[model samples]
Target: MRTAYSVETVRAAERELMDRLPDGALMRRAAAGLAATAVRMLGWVYGARVLLLVGGGDNGGDALLAGALLARRGAAVTAVLLSPDRAHPGGLAALRAAGGSAGPAAAVSGRALVADLVLDGITGIGGSGGLRPEAAELLARLEARRPGAAEPAVLAVDLPSGVDADTGEVPGAAVRATATATFGAYKPGLLVDPGRQRAGTVRLVDIGLGPHLPPQPDLLALQHSDVARLLPLPSPESDKYRRGVVGVAAGSARYPGAAVLAVGGALRGGAGAVRYAGHAAEGVVAAHPETLVSGGAPREAGRVQSWVVGPGLGTGAEAERAVAQVLEADVPVLVDADGLRFLDPGQVRARRAPTLLTPHAGEAAALLDVAREAVESERLVSVRELARRYGATVLLKGSTTLVASGGRPVRVNPTGTGWLATAGSGDVLSGLAGSLLAAGLDALDAASVGAYLHGLAARLAPEPCTAVEVAAALPSAWQQVRATAGTD
Candidate 1:
């Protein structure tokens, strides 16, 4: 898994390392990595024009020391000190000794676009709120210089200026970086939205602080290796009954395709048997012959290890009845789509079995009785809130899919392309997740693994693939997961 630590965790780790190392060792280590990245970004350091937007803290120190290194290598490096009084004296001395010059912040106006690179050292983990007035003015001037001109490659030290280091929320104004060279570890802000969009390609510089950190991560992205371990594998003695059965209660006469898509996803998912219990059983059987068709409610449906409710289940009496039946089932339940719309947190809480809710922004908004925009704005908070309210795991889908169980750290799915946002996608996700739940994975693991596979399948598909294609791609996705198990 790709783990992200909070700014507080990173600061603590840095502090521990600082206590052990020599006085200026950490800054030098960070600067050396920053200089190397700048060199790679510019292709050649010699004769290149570089501009550094120096701030007041160690963030500026990193940029100054890196500028000094580039200056010594024949690059024309200039530091525009935003706070000259608090600038790192050691770094400034190093730069002057290496032939780099310091200039006023106003020097950025005309020459910024001509420079090969712009190092944004305006803020770091210690910073709060938006950019200071002077820094904001300089950025505005730089932004106005070019619409689509080939300007300098903007690189940020620690984080892009103006982004919240802790929450990843770009409150007012933030710098748009082409690349960010962060020290120690990945921050939560870099993994979450708004802030994630501003932070382009993120590079982590090993300043030897990894060992001082805690085991629990604030945010995590499942990689192929994580998926491989979490994925259910069958043994030689496994049978349809032994492996696990998934029961799906989805679709209506109005939307038969949802049943087909859900069953399609279930067939490809790692389930021993898939039972379809709804009005659309014929459609499910027609699409997937392997699925055992049952024309009744989920409660009366034959034995199933897990149940998936929702997905094209239209609102009204029938949908509510289906939802009610699934809630009372003995096995784990995954609720999605229209089911999420008709859900009651009290009813979900009363259930004896584990329940998982998968809702895109709209469904999540409906569940919370809040605006869809609110859920999107604070995705982590929204997911956790929903999980706490329903006493079940909640997966909020978007650019960064967040899965949160009550009191557990949220798991963010960083896999998948924008193509996964197409119609009927949630149905496929629900089916796959339900199958994993049937295979005995906990609510969080089922949701996270399913999302990871769903994304990997979309990525593997020819771009612009439909939901059916995503469902069809699950087998290959699982195969890829198993193939990379030991290697990762």
Candidate 2:
């Protein structure tokens, strides 16, 4: 799993490493990594003009040492000191000793000042708010010099200046970086939004701080290896019944494709058998000949290890009845799409079996009785709150899909692409998750593994693929998972 540490955790880890290492050793390692990345970004270091925006902290120390390395490699490096007197003394001396020059922050203007790259070291984890007025003015002036002339590639040190390192919030103006060279471990801000958007491509530079980290990370994303271990694999002695069956109640005459997509996903998700009970039975049978069509109510649909309800299910009495029946079942239930609209947290909390709720930002907002923007603003807190309110697993779908169960650490699915946002996507997701649930995975693991596979499948599919294409790509995603399991 790809784990993210909070700012406080990173600081503690750094302290442990610093106690054993010589003075300035960690900074040198971080700076060397940064310099190597800069060389690769600029193609050739010789004669390349580089600009460093220096601040008053260790962040500036990183940039100054990197400038020293670049100068030794024949690059024309200059540091624009925003706080000259308070700058890292050792770093400034190193740069000067290596033939790099320093200039007033206000001097960054005109064609003569254009640079091949700009390193933002204005702030670090200690930064609380936006850029200072002087820093902002200097950036504006530098930006104005280029006037959309393919502005100098920006590389943020640790994080983009002005972004909250812990919350990913851009309280005010923040620099946009083409890449970010971070020290220690990945920060929560680097994976979350505002900061995520600012951080284009992230590169982690190890400063030997991993030994001090806690076993449970603050945030985590399931990788292929984690999914492989968690996914249910049928044994040679297992029968069809032992493998598990998933029952789905989804779609209406108005939205028949939803049923087909959901069943399609279940079939590829390792379910031994799939039972369909809904108004769109014909559509399910026609689209997937293997699906067992049930003409009775969901509660009467023989037996199933897990149930997937909602997904294009229309509102009103009929949809409500189906939801109630799923809740009454002894098996785990995955509620999604339209089913979310009729759900009551009180009823969900009373259920004995595990429940997983998959909702987009809008549906999540409705469940919480808040604006859509409110849930989007703080997704980590929002998903956790939903899980606590219903006593179930809640998966909030978006750019960084978050999955949280009652009092558990939130798992973010990092494999998804924007292309997965097509029609009937959530229906496929719910079916896949329900199949995992039937295979004996817990609610949280089922939701996270299902999301990880669904996203990887989307990315593995050919570009411009439809929902059907995503379902077809599941086997490849599963194969990739198994391939990585041994290594992990």
My TM-score estimates for the predictions, one after another, are: 0.96, 0.94
Q: Assess each prediction's global lDDT (C-alpha) against the native.
A: 0.88, 0.88
Candidate 1: clashing pairs of residues: none
Separately for all candidates shown, the number of backbone clashes (residues 3 or more apart, or on different chains) is 0, 0
RMSD of 1: 1.8
Positional deviation of residue 69's Cα in model 1 after best superposition, in angstroms: 1.3
> Candidate 2's residue-wise lDDT over 1-488, tens digit each?
77888889889888888899999899999999999889988999999989899999999999999999999999998899999988999999999999998866766446545899999998888898889999888777777864467678999999999888876777777888999999878887788775788998998888777888888888887776778789899999988778899999998878888988998888877778899999899888988999988867898777999999998888978988999999989899999998998888899999999999999999999999999988876777788889999999999998888899876667888887888989988888899999999888999999999999999999999888789999989899999889877785
Report the CA-based lDDT of candidate 2 relative to the real structure.
Answer: 0.88
The window of 10 residues in a row where model 2 has the poorest summed lDDT is 104-113
Q: Candidate 1 on 320-397: residue-level lDDT in tens? A: 999888888878999999888778789889888899999999889888989998887778778889999999999899
